[model samples]
Target chain A: MGPEVMPLLENRNDIDLVLWQQDCACDRKWFLENVQGATAIIVMFGDKVDSELFEAAGPQLRVVSTMSVGYDHIDVKEISKRKIKLGYTPDVLSDAVADICIMLALMAGRNARESMAVVNEGKWPNYSWAPFLFCGRQLSSTATSQRTVGFIGFGRIAHATLARLIPFGYTHCLYLANPSSAPATARDAALAAQHHLQSVQRVDADTLAATSDVVFVLAPGGAATEHLVGARFLRRMKPTAVLVNASRGTLVDSDALATALRERWIWGAGLDVVTGEPNIAADHPLVKEPRCVVVPHIGSATIETRIDMATLAVNNALAAIAGEAMPASVEF
Target chain B: MGPEVMPLLENRNDIDLVLWQQDCACDRKWFLENVQGATAIIVMFGDKVDSELFEAAGPQLRVVSTMSVGYDHIDVKEISKRKIKLGYTPDVLSDAVADICIMLALMAGRNARESMAVVNEGKWPNYSWAPFLFCGRQLSSTATSQRTVGFIGFGRIAHATLARLIPFGYTHCLYLANPSSAPATARDAALAAQHHLQSVQRVDADTLAATSDVVFVLAPGGAATEHLVGARFLRRMKPTAVLVNASRGTLVDSDALATALRERWIWGAGLDVVTGEPNIAADHPLVKEPRCVVVPHIGSATIETRIDMATLAVNNALAAIAGEAMPASVEF
Candidate 1:
């Protein structure tokens, strides 16, 4: 739901394509009007790829590529039954998301909004210069010459974000990854060690949330992880903690996050991905809260990332139709 | 003139010293009106303390205690010839001034204003997120685990500011102090070595301005150092350089600074002192220019620093009148 990805179809015709750019709720009238003549349909989260639509599209339909990682929009059972190819863009935007996470962390910790309000209010004369007028949190160094950074997820973006924080005087990193199978957990441990981070034994989510100075939510967002940072998880956080979310909107409940900010459950929250995209009004509890800094979902919107994504999406469609290996085809 | 140092008091107690505090300028008018019976005057800068005012106050005036570092407003020659004791506040606000210098440097280099403006203006969503949206020059880290910080003046606040920048990544410091004094240069070099700075060399102003990534103007302010950062010195700077000034308003020419910022003479400027202090309105040339940030002189405005200054000023008056050592008298 960022910008229309149809700019991907501007002129390249090496591959025959069927563009069904439906971004709304799935309906029989909408599906029959456009998707019936397509070889493949590029749909987002809201569109349902039910049996009726698939049958309506008929024999020419060769692929169903959901723009998002989650494919709840598509009835995957029917797609697998027909053995159609699928594609999604992930990992590519991790760096962008990570960058936003850090931006939010710094902005929230510094109380940038309130500080700016001071200057704008024309109260500079009455306000005496002080050693610490708006001193909030130090992002980098500590009195001990060592600072600890923590992440709630150990995904690609989380690692990249960790790399950025290292230069800011972070010497220790704590991470909480979803409990993995034996082989995957071993890989995770090795990755953590490679990054010079200790692979502390996986603990409950509450422990990770409590101990981290900065907790980043970069996990997969679905029913299994809904409202992961509710009141209980929030209460466990350090008083000076900063929470960042660049993953999915549903991973956090906005009401819970707002309450935490209001009651000082945590120092601040930087949210790039809120529970509902674009629908968050200024009056939304979190938006109105001083400490909670909300940014519109722009995690993967960098020029380099966007161009790479477009090229990959195009290649994925072409390769799927030509019966070739797609660069980043979704396994699920 | 800063709000702290502007009033010229005429009477020993016109505005009821214990209550009904007035602006420094108002206090100056009150002092002028009531000076005929006054024995001493507790004054700040910007009030004309000349032969006329002295003659008006008559021969009873024994001392003049200025609540500021600079005494350009008072005729030192007249005071010396008259044998009246003079006192001015110094050494108190050095740390506070240093803090503001560092804050401005960090804020400018990070493009904090522009990014915050974008968010405030609601252009964040249309503008895609990127890894380098506001990637500005990081002042602290450079040259292999250590940063080399150079100052144009090795005064008290410059040393204090250097100390603050040390933990952020500065390991080497270079300085240019009073050109005529070799002993002053040696003292600074020894201090730098004590702080673990690689070297502190006394270079000419031109060389100091050129080689430094962040050049601070912390020298005494007066006619002797007017327009120090003119066309030639700015031309020699790196494109990523930042200039911080917390010393005096007259030290930098506002027009030249605006031109430098517009022409990219150096990366940006963090100015707590300008050509004119509070007179810098919205349409001021520097205010109109991008990358040139200006703050009304609020150095030493912290609660602790202010209380110390007020107490010191009061103590200086008491000591001068009672024939004891003035706590921090500015001896010429």
Candidate 2:
């Protein structure tokens, strides 16, 4: 565990704490042995919470708290069957992730990666200042006649992202609501009125792809959203549109988006998450694409947000161990 | 000139157009020879409009319209003496420059250059996702207790930048106004109410630097503001504060900023303009600072803005030639 969460677990007299002290990943053998007889376990994104680990912890383990919003690494089925309470940080990270979403959108649209690379490679001296050199698509609606911002998901993070765009004179907001949810006409109307947007409508994927000058992938990652922004979606997008992915890596197809960028199907892309993260090779197709600005999985890497998440995770574990309700429990 | 403005200059029956048909700088001899017997001369940022050029034009030079906002390159004193109407594109590019200001602030606060460089250097596979690794200061006020945004000059571009920050929850606005202007008590109050900000006040340079979470150097470039953000000002800033320059390069001392960043006196900086630009070496102190994100002067380098500037320059010159007031004339 990081030092941010260390103080919370240090002075507890009623409970014992075992931490993986090194910066590297904890040894599986060590984790299995240390988790024995523990009433609760705190895990991060890389640690898999499964039946094998739960069985090793015996019937005494009552809860599992993760310092992340995504629980894809956790086997929900096994935890549900065991009636183990699960706590995951959610709303605390929305602001940080939304901030990065806008950052990536601006970076990708403004050609920051390539332009900065030119400076870093010592090429600025030879480059002349022409009217058109390094010109990029403007993010604000002030310069454009019409600006449409589209989102794949309209949850907390999406709303936050929309709020940021409104000040930039984004006139229209289009989003694809979850299939399971009812129509969001009232919600859209309320948002439009509050932000003074031209209109906010829930549209079909095709319309969202075709009309949006900038598209944001803010959906969850899993089987339901795997490759949601593949070749078909890319092909339908405006040639001047910019795509930003700050949600989950799996929602986008790396190769397809790369090809789309190279072929000029879309203007550019800014990405924080990729299909396979931490392992994203330097020669990955998305990284190799000049129009693509790729970063490691750092959507919620802000200092304040990470500290808040750790504090919440520690408090949730403490509450569970004390036979009290967790502050942010994930319902089965 | 690029294709965007060619149509405006083409097919003019009554006008004689002398085109400098090369990508390189216009030769001095060619410019002097061609400018003679010319009624108007359209210039760019690097083209100097001095007494010698004015004399060479032989009283036929009715106007000098530059395709840029900055007139530091032009000899305004000589132009005024010769009664040459001066035109420059100002408000047209404010949106573009403002957009880049916000981009740099977010980029600096988020460690984009260094983090992206890590990925580009083939080091991602070896880097682990730690809770604190590459963690940066959050740009939004939502994550911060009290967010303060300060500006050295609060003119069109600065206000445009402030508008972009409102959605990010920047509650307080502080700026160092021009010394000649009256105290903006009523104006600041009106602006505060209009923007729904906590307060908007004109403060001193020291207070602006000390309290601002992000400081923007947006004042004009010249002797009056040279090295305004030097070591003393940088030392007064919060260790977590970020400095952004989208206005004039001469307003900031590059060496001071580099030293501040290296010594951890300031968190980071984002510069769109720097002193002695286009000639800035790759080994320059500011360029070598890991915390500094340096881009070639591209504050107004957006397709829409550039086209608008070029069109405005052409129209201003044509209007002057026709014995009419230029659209955006700079009064002597």
Candidate 3:
């Protein structure tokens, strides 16, 4: 359980509490033994909720609330089979994640990794500023031209990011939404007008890869979306374009991205989540690239947002305990 | 001379070119000897333009154009005394610099320095993601509260930054404009209505320091403005606030800022320029702080922006040579 969620649940007299106090992921052995008869469980993103966990919990588990926006770590099929209600924090973290998305996009385009190293490694004294030293791709639109931004997922977080990008003078937006959804050209037109963009086109992945100056991957992480941004898509991207990933790590292929950056297929990449995060080392292919700016899965990490997510998760659990609807329920 | 500017001037058969071919700052002996008979001189920030250089030029110089925004390195008083036209690239690079201002603010507030170190230093393997492990202050406004932004100098770049910030839901703006400018409450109200912000007010430095959640120093660099953000100013700031400097490094006192961060008087600082830059080493106090994010003066170092600046500098010099008004001239 998150430390913030402890106080919110500790004051309740009607329930007995079993808290995992470690800052890291709960120990597997302890979690399996302690979760034996839990009526409801609060899980972090690091915890995998699967058949084994469900089998340990027995049949009385009525809720599994996660303190995160992504439920990819949870086994939705298993939860549904057990008729357990799934609750996850979503809307509360959209703004924070969107802020990081814009931050990463700017960092990637501006060559932040190399520049920061220059300052932190004591290279500035000998580093002379040429007319074009450390020159990078600019994010804001110039007076003469506008920039276009593309998104792989046009959901709540993407919309929030779009709102922030409009003021940077990005006049065109391209997005690849759910492939199965019906095309909404009229809706696209309305969105463009509303955001003051010249156009918001619903394009195929190839066109988006080729056309956008900045490509954002904000889609879900699942089997279907795994490796959505692979070699084929990357090779089609503009040589000077930037790719930002603030969503699920599995959506982007790390190997393909590393190669693309190494060979200059794409200018740079900024990632908040990686395929096997918390295990990404200095020698990791992507981290080794000077152009790739990687942070450890901090997409929704903000003081206020984290507290809100914890409170919401706790609320979802408490609501379930009271035989009430979870505040942010997943209809699986 | 800048490499880009050389090509722009080389093809012009009307003018003779004496180029400094080195990528670094020109040697003192070469510069003084070569500049003796020159009718015009173009300079970068590293090249100081004081009375000594004017004496060396034998009073024949008609124009002093710099390929930068800040002119503190130039002796503006001497230029005015000689009636020499001073040209600079201003409006062209505002968007780029403003983009960096926003980028720095986000980075400073998001614990970018330490978080990035963890990934770059091979420490992520043992790093655990707690609820508040790397959580930082959010830049965007939450549903419950709107954030306030303050500016030390409300000029072209600050306004551009403000335009970009509005989409992040910054509802209030406080600024310390030119001290001698008359009170313009009506102007402030109009500015607020134009941006759809709740309020925009010209306030004293003390009030600005005390009120803002983010403070941006965008004023010019000179004796009058040097150390404008000193110990007292920083002490007045909120403990959770962020400070960003993109304009002139001399405007901030580095030692005071370092102490502020060390003592937890402020949350973080993001700086593009620093006093005695190109000399700041790894042991520099600000760089030593994990909360401070310093880049080596890359505010306007974007490919397109630099080209535009170089081209503009060349054009300004040629226009002055032709006895026409410079495209961008600094008036006394």
lDDT for every model?
0.65, 0.88, 0.91
Candidate 1 ranges with C-alpha deviation above 4 Å = A1-332, B1-20, B23-27, B44-53, B70-75, B142-146
lDDT (Cα, tens digit) per residue for candidate 1, span B1-332: 22442242224453323221443353545566677755557666656677777887788777887767768778888888777788877777665566566667765665555644455455554443232344456654522335566676677778777766654556667676665755565676677776667777777767777777788888777777787777777888777888888787777777778888898878888776677555555567776655765656655554445545665666677677677988887666
Which 10-residue span in candidate 1 chain B carries the lowest summed lDDT?
Answer: B1-10
- Writing each residue's lDDT as its tens digit, candidate 1 over A1-332 gives 22444455655576454443443344558667767767766664546688888888887788776555556557777888887778766666555455566667765665655544454444444543332345456554432345566676666777767765654546666666676634356765665675555543455687777667778887777676788878888888887878888787787888988888898888887776777555555567776787876656655544445544555666577677777887677665
True contacts kept of each: 0.02, 0.56, 0.81
TM-score of chain A considered alone, across all candidate predictions: 0.84, 0.96, 0.97
Task: Give residue B51's error in model 3 in angstroms.
Answer: 1.2
Q: What is the DockQ of each candidate?
A: 0.08, 0.66, 0.77
Give model 2's docking category: medium
lDDT for model 3, please.
0.91
What C-alpha lDDT, on a 0 to 100 scale, does residue A178 get in candidate 3? 86
Model 1: per-residue Cα lDDT at residue B162:
77
Point to the candidate with the largest DockQ. Answer: 3
lDDT of 2 by residue, A208-312 (tens): 999999999998787888998999999999988999998888999999999999999998999988887878777989889879998777788888888898988
- CAPRI rating of model 3: medium
- DockQ result, candidate 2: 0.66
Please tell me how candidate 1 rates in CAPRI terms.
incorrect
